[model samples]
Target: MTDTLTVKSQRRHLHPAALRIMHWTNAIAMILLIGSGWKIYNDEVLFGWLHFPDWITLGLYAQHGLQWHFFAMWVLMVNGLCYIAYGFYTGRFRRKMLPIWPRAVIADIKAALTFKLAHDDITHYNAVQKTLYVGVILVIVLQVITGWAIWKPVQLSALVNLFYDFQGARLAHFLGMTAIVLFLVVHVALALLVPKTIGAMITGGPKVTADPDTDREPLPSPAE
Candidate 1:
């Protein structure tokens, strides 16, 4: 009986509070940045998807889009930095997030797309989730670099020169935003498809039940 209890505790579902906070905070910040970004982008009507009035602007001046963009950029940067720090300190970065092997990652990706759970019987984040999580982090880093080029073309002239001058930076920035938007769309869709995922995020606990017989396992030590 004691052994069974131990196993149940080990298999208990848990997610760090820090991760949950960062996840929601990042979502909100992205929404704000995207909305404000669209308003700024209307300066030249870059995309025809949405329209904004020229006179009614959020920034001090029509050209002040850069100011708002920079302000929001700082929010994202600071939040991301904190997350990275936590990931490194806790070592959860390696144990939980970093895939054990390339084959594992590939298999996980396949499982995630097919909505199949692994041996644990819970469709927690399969391979695709891990890939996207890591990929998005890389995208954020690139966004920062391209953003710098756009914000300070003169200072970052060398970097901007690699892409295609200031024009290239602008294009990169647009693409980065598009990438996040696409990910968010798919993420939300998947969450709706699997309501348990949404609940898991909100509650910081798995919505799936573990089998008493086979699900018993030792809980990994908490990250130091």
Candidate 2:
């Protein structure tokens, strides 16, 4: 009982303020970008015969939506940089995330295949979660790169060239957006399935279990 208490108590500080801020910022930026981008597509969709419905998009008009999209793009870019820099400078990636071992992913997946895979503790993300997190970052990077390439093909000719042309960049950007939306769906679903994770992200962390002998709450993080 004592050992269990110690392990659970360790979750007192689940996410640093920096991490939480970046996370929610990125989420908001992504949502805005998606809505605005869909509206832009409604004007002239590159993909298929189907036009993105105007009703589902932001601003009620193509030009208005384009403006919003550009604004959201800037927000995504700046917030993304902060997220990356914070992860690197603070060692958040090394310490809290990507703690994989030989066959650990396979083991975790197999265990999760039983379909009760919700993990409550922020300190104990499984291999599958880590992999998904990494994937989401990569997708975000791709979105940024391709978005920049399309936004200013002439100014960013070098980036556009890497994708072969603006056409290629646009296609890649569209695919990146699709991937991101799908990931968001899975991410939210998992959060709902997990106990206290979404709440922890919002308000620092869940109320931890104190040992029976002590009625005191855990001390807050003294610094970021």
Model 2 lDDT, full chain set: 0.77
Q: Write the per-residue lDDT of candidate 2 for residues 48-157, one digit (tens) a residue.
A: 78677666778778788888888988888999998887776655676556666648778888878998565755666788888778888999998988988998899999
Clashing pairs in 2: none
Off by over 4 Å in 2: 1-12, 206-224
lDDT of each: 0.69, 0.77
CA error at residue 56 for candidate 1, angstroms: 14
Across 59-172, the per-residue lDDT of candidate 1 in tens digits comes to 655456666666778888899898887776655565456664678787777776686744343344456676787778888888888988988899879999978878778888
